[model samples]
Target: MAVAAAVIRCRRLNIPRAFVISMMINAIQAAIGRSMDPLLTPPAGNSLHIKASSVDGVQIYTCSGGEWRFLSASASLVDSSNSSIFIGTYAYVYSPKHVSAIGTWSLNNSEGVIAESGHAASEVTGRVIAFRGNKFALPAFLAQASSHLFDGTASLVSYIQQIPSDGGVPPGSSSCRKGSRQVHIPFEADYWFWTQDRQPPSVPSELSAIGLMIEGFFGTGHVKYVFNGTSWQQKNITASMYDVPGGILVGRFFIESHADDAGGSFTWEVFNPNGWTVTAKSASPGVQVDGSSLPWRLFSVTSASFNESFLGPITQVQMISTRGGLPPTPMQAQAVVETWKIMLLQWSFKVCMKISDSECTIT
Candidate 1:
């Protein structure tokens, strides 16, 4: 037969190759057309080409039959039963329009919600609030004024200075300006002294009848007197005089040599108004009045020469000669005798005196 019987070459059937080819084709088809539930789905043939979404939550993709079904639950939107929701301690649940019903609420000790004015009538405002001790009012009048604000160190110093110190008088008080006036006694006279006297002189002699002023100032007493001579001298007297109140007179004197006569001398004595004696004797270069161990008194001798003179309250006088025991001289050493005297005078005066009208008997 002319049929192409001859071309029937017997080729060995490649079953293993065919099987491998069929398996590859099946895997490709599974990857392209297979669909599965996410929970029960198997791995895709190719690496999954999953497009990532920007949304944050639990997302699931399922391939069922031949189409992709995406399932997602957004944490922000989903109301999951087992979801962790943190409710602050201070959170209040009230209708949005009914803000007046909201009150201070605290959860645990941490979070709280408080009213704006801390009053029941005020609306609840603060979120994530805390109860710090007690609530206080918003200072309306500023506990103080802005003008009272201290801005600098100088202002603060002035404010502190204005504060009254302890034991101090406040401003505008009468005692604030009250002060004690201090009166000081003048001790200019070199013969100034004072004492307490208990007796008076027996007679008006050179050793007595001398009164000293006893003035009291600032709770203390003082006596003062003047010495005519410029130099201090020793006196021969060691007894005290009992005279005026608070007067104790001791003999004290200053001596000087005769200016006109060589080897001649003069002595001065100051006697207390009470019985007290003071005698100045002649010595080389000058007369020395031994006033050692003398009591306190005040006296003044205006003149050293023994003479009959009356000056201000001075009434009596005495004279004594010191030239008796001197050595012989070429000329007749006539003993020069001098007299000394003292006067008493009132030194204080008062200008006015007030008598009660009821006590006054006017004639």
Candidate 2:
């Protein structure tokens, strides 16, 4: 009777028929559960629908018939941008699909505290790139595209030449032009740094911007002779690398370290961004090794890949035996191998990728 009286008064006034009808529908639906009775059929997977409510007195249950009773938690209506929606109390954030370049492209929290982007599992692990707590192809934030720090003329003089933006750093700078492989990735900088920062430790202050210190593969399993700064194989460095399962890495910067390896001083690890629940150390191990004596060699991830190297005292045994169990001769003139080596193998377990991002990935 009250509803009818209100409608009659509105009609006599200037209320439109459509508005009256919408208000009455809302009121009636509120009094009942929803417009449609809760149907017994479950909503199709990945699809949304509101079936008849499962109401027992005041308590509400979902339409899907599973548990003898999955009780409903309290929900509040949300109004934003001129629309109304409902959401649960807990929600997780994920990396964006389209923004591939190396920058924090999203922040779910309104306070701007969390930054999301691509990051290596860590300098030591180097197994998989990560993002937003998962594995992903997100690019490591080397520098802005215009920073020129990765443009082959970096003040630090990176051991790597400026390869094309097309993922040629690991194989060879020339691999891209020959189309030897498709190194398609979300990053624009394909680079390597033999030394932790690539520049001489005494470089000008302006060149202190920092670089990604990584493991660059060189000469057939590490033992190499250099002449005039050139390796015996006539090559120096081939690539810096990590393992990616199925050649697909998805993430935004949140990384994990692999378990410890007691056999060797270094450990290899990776993380997946696809919600993998593996326990991981969130930071890279602070380790570094020198590649000054390492030479170029072919390395492979799966079977079809090549050009890889790592940091180890490959010649340490040879150096020991050089004395022939007697007094050592004068060190071989340091010129041939010292000045002519192809690439330096400076290994560092922990490295700061950017000049300004100390422990920033965790932030």
Candidate 3:
């Protein structure tokens, strides 16, 4: 196998034995994680889960060769009130409508607005432009902030995710020709922005980089977080909790225990009839769960069936915040265990390979 060859090469290169083993473990985890969600796997490590904005835009397509090809996207990033906060675009284009827009602004504006002054544009990744149809699924994206607006919403943003939504597929090839030129199809999606280190007030400050913020106490508690530009605060819930992996999939089922270096697992099947089941594929060492000595682990969704799913088409999931979920130490003992935890599930994009600042589109 290719993995076996890679390991042999690593050994031949005089690499540390421990480093080689860690690399192999990560490779295996990533491979299994892909089985959970093929297209939208969030990058591992620490990152602050920030804001989610609604995007109403058009997917542009141009007829070329013998088929219709995707050109770019033109959209508006709106806030909770549905008011346009910034413009979203793929390539560079100067809009005549707004002076200091988010996507593409004049490199040299008469109002003294320029990229050097921090009024730059944004670049997007994770769009499935080649496929066209109702069933065509677009992957979730991660957009890096280049030049930011003065208001500071997009300033601290390290990445942006375009959550899957309906009505974005391009027109059929039968409708376009070489002479058909370009067509704009209207579409809507939610874009989640992320920073380096920031947490919601309800979530503990120590547990950072939460893609999902979950808070509950044993079987009877509440789940609080945000999605699709909507706030979900203190939603009541019920479920069973287990210290080990397997079973009916209600509450926390530990797959990979934090205490173990080889890692363990856990699953959350809180929503019955149509809920998501997230499982831990690996363990991230160092950081401890909120108030506990146990390190928080990241999970991938193995199955999902929610009636009103905020995690549309499924993306990335991780237990960003936690409180009192670890097994008791030798001295501590209790008949009943109640724990508070937060799990974040959002989609992510792979870093564009071989990219330059002048051309940042994912190739």
Highest-scoring model, TM-score = 3
Per-residue lDDT over 1-363 for candidate 1, one digit per residue giving the tens place of the 0 to 100 score: 001222232222245654665576457547634222221121111122111111122222233333323222121211122225321111223344643221221111112212322322111122111111111211010000001111211111100000111111111222123242222111110000111111111211222212221111000111222223332222322111111211223222223434323322222333434322222222212221111111222122233333221112222222211111122221322221112222111111000001112121221
Q: Model 2: how large is the Cα RMSD against the reference?
A: 30.7
Which digits, one per residue and each the tens of the lDDT, describe model 2 over residues 1-363? 001121211111123644565476446446633212222111111011111111111212222222212122211212122223221111112224523222111112222222222321111101111122112221232211111111111211111111123221222233334223333222232222211222112211222222222221111112222344322442221112211111122211111232333222121222332121111122222111112222111111111111122211111000000000111112643443444444333211111111122122210
Segments of candidate 3 deviating more than 4 angstroms: 1-56, 81-138, 144-151, 198-363
Ranking by TM-score: 3, 2, 1
Give the range of the ten consecutive residues with the poorest summed lDDT in model 3. 347-356
Which lDDT tens digits does candidate 3 get at residues 270-360?
4544444544344234355243413443333433345134322332233433322233332432221222233222211111000012211
Candidate 3 residue-wise lDDT at 106: 13
For all predicted structures, in order, the TM-scores are: 0.12, 0.15, 0.33
Residue 347, model 3, lDDT: 16
